[model samples]
Target: MADYRLHTIFYILTSLLSLAVLHWTVHKVLLSISRSKFKKANNCQPIPKYPNKDPIFGYDYWHALNKAAESRTLLSWLREQYRLYGNTYYARLQTANVISTCDPENLKAMHSTKFKDFAIDSRRKFAFLPLLGAHSVLLANGAAWEHKRAMLKPSFSRSQYTNLPLFERHVGHLIEAVRVENTKKGQVDLAEFFLCLTVDITSELMYGTSIELLTNGNKDLVRDMTQSAEGGHARWLLVFLANIIGNSTFSKSVSKVRNFMKRFVDEAISYRQHSESRSISAKPTARNFEGQQGTEPLDVKGRVIYLQQLSLGTRDRKAILDELTTILFAGRDTTAALLTNLFFVLAHRSDIYDKLRAEISVLDGERPTFEQLKGFNYLQSCLNEALRLYPVIPINTRMAVVDTTLPVGGGPKGQSPIFVSAGTNIAFHVTALHRRKDLWGEDAEDFLPERWEKIQGQGAWMYQPFGGGPRNCPGQHLSLAEAAYTVLRIVQEFSMITGRDSEPWTELIALTCTNANGAKVTLTEA
Candidate 1:
C-alpha cells in the first residue's frame, strides 16, 4: 500500500510540472506572434542601439551615466550620446530595455498626440509615494490624475497668482536678505536666497501663512524637506532595492515635512468650520509694494488663499495635503532654479543686464502690474533664453502603458516609426532638444536673449521650458510672473551686478537643476 501511494504522488507532481511548462510555452508563442503583427502593422523599424561593451545588460552605459551624474556632467554626457547615436537610440539597462530621445517629434507624440498611451512609470510613483501621497497629481494617471488636476486648477487661476502685493512682501524679504549677506560677506549667493524666497512665497500661497525661511524662521523645515527630497531621488535611482532595504533617516525627514504640512491642513479646515458656524468670512491682509498696510482685494472678494480654495473642494485632509504638497514642491523649485540660472548669466553679461534694466526703467521706478510684466519684450526674451539654456526639469521619462509607436526615432536616419513594447521606458532629454543646433540655429549653445527677438516663435515642441500637453505645468504664469517681477525689482535696486565666481555654471540637480557653484554675485546698490 505504501509503494502504491508513493507512485501516485510522483505521477501527480510530474503532471503539474508538465502543465506549467506547456502554459509558459504557449504564452511566449502568443506574445511573439502579437509583437510580429504589431511591428508589421505599424511599419516599425529597428532603432539605433548603443554600442555597449556588455550588450546584454548595457553595464558599460549604466556605469558611464553614474560617473557623469557624480561629476555633475550628466546633461553634457546625454547631449554627447544623442550626437553620437542620432536623435534617439536604444540601450539595455539591466533587464529592461530603455529608449533615449531628444527628438521633438517623439516628445510631441508622447506628451500630446498620444498622451493616453503612456503613463508615469510605477518606479517613479513608488519612489515619490512617501513624499507625495499615493493620490498626488504628480504620480496619478488616467482618471485619478484628471480628478486631481480639476481640483487643483481653480486654485491656480489668474486672480490667485496675480496678487502682486503678496509677491512684493516676499520679494522685500529676499532683497533685505541679499543686502545683509552683501554687507557681511561682500558677495551674495543669490541661488540660496532664491530658494528661500520661493519657499516663503510658496508656503504663504499654499498654506495661507509663510514658514518665513527668508527671515530665518523654520530653518529645520527646509533642511528636513531637502533631506526628504534627496532620499526620494536616491530611492528612484535604486528602485529595485528600495523596497527591501529601508532608510530610517529618509522616513523621519519625510514624516517631519508631512507633519509640518498637516498642521496647516488641520488649521485651514478648523478655521473654515469656525467661520461657517459663526457665519463670518475670513480676510487676510498684506503690505503693498509701498510698505503700506491694507487688505488686498481680488475681484472684490478677499484675498484668494489656496488652502481655503482647496477646503471647498473636499474635506478629506489627506487628499488636500497631497495636492498642496505636490504644488508646493513644483512651484518652489521651478521658480528658484529659473531665477538662479537666469541671474547667473545676467551677472556675467553686463550688456544683457543693462538692456533688461533699460526695459524695466519704463516703469520709472514704479512697481509692475501683471499686464506690464507680461508686455516687457526684452524681459520675456531673457527669461525665454534662460529657460532654453537651463531647463529646470532637464530630463523626463514616460512608460508605455500599451504597445505604441513613436512618430520618429527608428531606421537609419531616425525618421521612421519605432514600435514601443508595453512596459518600455522612454526618456526624453529636454536640455538636448533645447540646445539642438538644427532646431535653434548654430548659436543655440550661446545664451543670447536677442535670439527671441529674431524668431517669430520657438515653434511647437521646440521651447517647452514649462513642458507641453495636458500634464504641462499649471503654474507656468505664476512662476514667470514671480521671476520677472523679482528680476525687475532687483535690477531697479542695484545699479550693477558682477559675477564673483570665475567658474562656469555646472549643474546642481535635485528635483530641479540649478548652478552648482551657486549664483555668487556682488550687487552695487543703486
Candidate 2:
C-alpha cells in the first residue's frame, strides 16, 4: 500500500511540472509571433544597439551613466553618445529594454502623435509618490491625470498669472535681500536669492500669503523641500534598488514638507467651508484692464488666491493638497533655475547684458505691465536662448503602454520607423536635442540670442524648453513672465553686473537644473 501511494504522488508531481513548462512555452511562442507581425505590419527596422560590455545586464553602460552623473558631466556625456551612436539607440538594463533618443521626429511621435501609446511608468511614479502624493497630476496617468489636469487648469489661467501686483510685494523683499547681501559680502549669490524669491512668490499664490523666506530668513521649509526633491531624484536614478533600500532621511523630509503644506491646505478648506456657509460665491469676476478682458476671484483683501480657486473645484482635502504641492514644486524651481542660468551667462557676457538692458530701457524705470513685458522682443529672445541652453528640466522619459513604432530612429541613416515593445523605457534628452547642430546650425552649442531674431520660430519639436504636447508645463507662461519681470527689476537696480567667480557654469541637477557655482556676481548700484 505504501509503495502504491509513493508512485501515485510522483506521477502527480511530474504531471504538474510538465503542464507548467507547456504553458510557458506556448506563451513565449504566441508573444514572438505577435511581435513579428507587429514589426512587419509597421515596417520596423532594427535600431543601433549600445555596445555594452556586459551584454546580459548592460552593467557597464549603467556604471558609466552613474559615473557621469556623479562627476556632473551627465549632460555632456549624453550629448557625446548621440554623436557616437545615431540619434536613437537601444540598451539593456537588467530585465528592461531602454531606448535613448535626441531625435525630434521620435520625440514628437512619443509626446504627441502617439501619446496614448505611452505612460509615465511605475518606476517614475513610485519615485515621486512619496513627495507629490499618489493623486498628484505629475504622477497620475489616464483618467486620473485628466481629472487632476482639469481641476488645476482654472487656477493657472491668464488672469491669475498676469496680476503683476501679486508678485511685486515679493519682488520688493527680494530686492532688499540682495541689497543687504551685496553691502555685506561685496558680492551676491543671485541663485540663492532667486530660489528664495520664487519660493515666496509661489507660497503667496498658493495660500494668499507668503512664506517670506527672503525677509524672515526661515529656511527650514526650503531645506526640507530640497532634501525631499534630491531624494526623489536619487530614487529615480537608482530605480531598480529604490524599492529595496529604505531611505529614512527621504521619509523624514517628505513628512516635514507634507506637514508644512497641510497647514495651508487645512486653512484653505476651512475658509472655503466658511465662505460656503455664508453663501459667498467663489466664481471669478471679469475685469477690463488696459483694454484687455480677464477674470479672477479675489480674496477678502482683494488678492488673487490660487488655493481659494482650487478649493472651488473640489472640497476633497487630499486632492487639493496634492495639486498644490505639485504646483508649488514646479512653480518654485522652474523660474528660479531659468533666472539663475540666464544671470550666470549674463554675468559672464557683458555684451549680452548691455543688449538686454537696452531692450528693457524702454520701460524707463517704470514697473513693466504684462503687455509691456510681452512687447520686449530682445528680452524674450534672451529668455528663449537661456532655456534652450539650460532647460530647467533637462531630461525627461516616457514608457510604452502598448507595442508601437517611433516614426524615426531606425535603419542606417535613422529615417525608418522602429518597433517599441510595451514596457520599454524611452529617455529623450532635451539638453542634447537643443544642441543638435543639424537643427540649430553650427552655433548650436553657443549662447547666441541673435539666432532667435533671425528664426521665425523654434519649429515645434526642435526647441522644447518647457516640453510639448498634452503634458507640457502649464506654468510656463507664468514662469517666463516672472523671470522677465525679475530680470528687468534687477537690471534696473544695477548699472553693471559682472561674474565674481571665474569658473564656468556647472550643473546642480536635481528635480531641475541650475548653476552649481551659484550666480555669484558683483553689482554696481544704478
Candidate 3:
C-alpha cells in the first residue's frame, strides 16, 4: 500500500511538470510567430543569429556553453563569434535572445545616442542587489542614477590632488609586502597581493580607517567579495533556494557582508560626528606626498576624505553604503586586474619592460609627484594598451526598455539598422571591439603601446575600455593614477619582474577580469 501511494504521488508530480513545460513551449511558439509576423508586416529585418544546429532548446546553447566551459571563459567564445559573424550577431542564452555587437557606431547608439530607449538589464541588476545594495549608483535608474553621478562628481574631480598622497601610502604598503614575500617565498601571488593592496586602500579611503589587510590575515571580506562576484551554478541554486525560503547559505553570507559594511559605515559616521562636536586644533602643514610620513588635519580647506564627501552628498545611510561599496568594488578589482595584466605582459617582453623602466627612470629614484606622474606618456600608453587587450569588464549588457533600432549591422547584407524589440537584451563586446582591425590598425591584436601615441583622443567611441557616455566609470582618473604610480614604484624598487607563466595568462572573469590562476612572480631587488 505504501509503495503504491509513493508511485502515485510521483506520477502526479511528473504529469503536472510535463503539462507546465508544454504550456511554456506553446506560449514561446505563439510569441515567436507573432514577432515574425510583426517584423514581416513592418518590412523589418531581424538581426543575424549564429546557426543553431540543435534547436530543441530553442538555440545552440549547449554548444556555446560547452565551448565556453572548456575555455574557462565566455570571452574567448564571444571573440570567435565576432571573427565568424562580423561586428554584430545574436545568440540565445537560455530562453532569451542576446544580441552582441562590436561596431563602434552601434555601441555609441546604444550607450549614448539612443540611451533613452535602453536601460541596464533589470535581471542582472536584481541579481546584484544583495551584494551592491538596493540604492547602488551602478544599479539605479533614471533620475536617481543621474543624481548619484552628480553628487559623486565633485568628490572625484581633478582638483582632489590630496588623494595622490593616500595612493602613495598604500603603494608603499604594497611594496613592503612584496619585499617581505621576496624574502620569505621567492615568488609572490601578485594577483592576491594586489587585491589586498586595493582592499586596504579602498577601505581606508571609504571610511577614513584602514583595515590593513596587507599586514593582517583577515581577508574574509575580500574573499567573500570575490566569491560573490565569481558565483556559478551552485551560487545561483543557493540564491533560488534563498529566495524561496527567505534564508539559505547565500543569504546568510550576503547578510554577513551587509552587516559588516553597515557596521563600518556606522562607526565612520559616529567618528565624524564626535570629531565635529569637539574643538580641534589645526595641524601644521601638508603631509609629504612621497612617503605619507606625517598626519595632516582633516577638514582642511582643500582636502576631502571620501566618507566626508559622501556625507556631503547625501544624508541617507543606505545611499552612503551603496555608493561606498560600489566604489570599493569598482576601484579595487578593476585596478588590480589592470596591474595584474600589465605585469603579466611586462614579464615576457623585455623590450617593452625595458622601455617602461627607462621611462620611469626619468624620475631618478624619487617618487614621482602627481604632476610628474602625468608626464610619463609612455607609461600611460602601456596602461592603455593593457586595458585594450584585457578590459577589466570585458562584456556589458543592456536591455531595450522601448523598441529601438540600432545604427547598423542587420539584415542579410549586414549593414542596415537592426530593429530591436522592447525586451531584447544587447551586449557590447568590449574585448572584441578593442581588437577590431578596422577601428584599430592591422596590429590591433598586438601589444604595441606606440599605437596609443598616434591615436590618442582620436577615437573615443572605439577605444572605450573604461566605457563611455553618461554611465561610464568616473573612477578612471584615480584608477589610472594608482596603476601608474604602482608600476613606477615597482620598477624603481625591483630590477626585473619575471613570472612562472611565460605565455599569456588565461582570463578569469570575477568582480573584474583576473588571471585564471593567480599571477605568480618574483621581484629582483633594484
Candidate number of the best TM-score = 2
Q: Alpha carbon lDDT of residue 8, candidate 3?
A: 100
Arrange candidates by lDDT, descending: 2, 1, 3
Expressed as tens digits, the lDDT of each residue in 106-163 for candidate 1 is 9899989999999998767878899989758889998777656665565577865788
TM-score of each: 0.92, 0.94, 0.82
| Candidate 2, number of clashes | 0
What is the clash tally of candidate 1? 0
lDDT of each: 0.83, 0.84, 0.74
Q: Give each model's clash number.
A: 0, 0, 0
**Best candidate (score: lDDT):** 2
Model 2 alpha-carbon miss at residue 257, Å: 1.6
**Pairs with steric clashes in candidate 1:** none
lDDT per residue, candidate 2, 1-526, as tens digits?
9999999999999999999999999999999999999999998999999888788877888888888988899999998888998899998865568999998888888888899998897767878888998768888888767756655566567875787887787788888889998989899989888888998888876677788899888778778888898899888777868768888889999999888888878877887787778866455433211122323447675555677766665667887788779888888878999999999999999998888788888878889889998898888889999999998888888999998999988889898999999899999899999999999999998999988877776657988888778988888788888888888888888889989999888987878888889799999898
Q: What lDDT does model 1 reach?
A: 0.83
Cα lDDT of candidate 2 equals 0.84
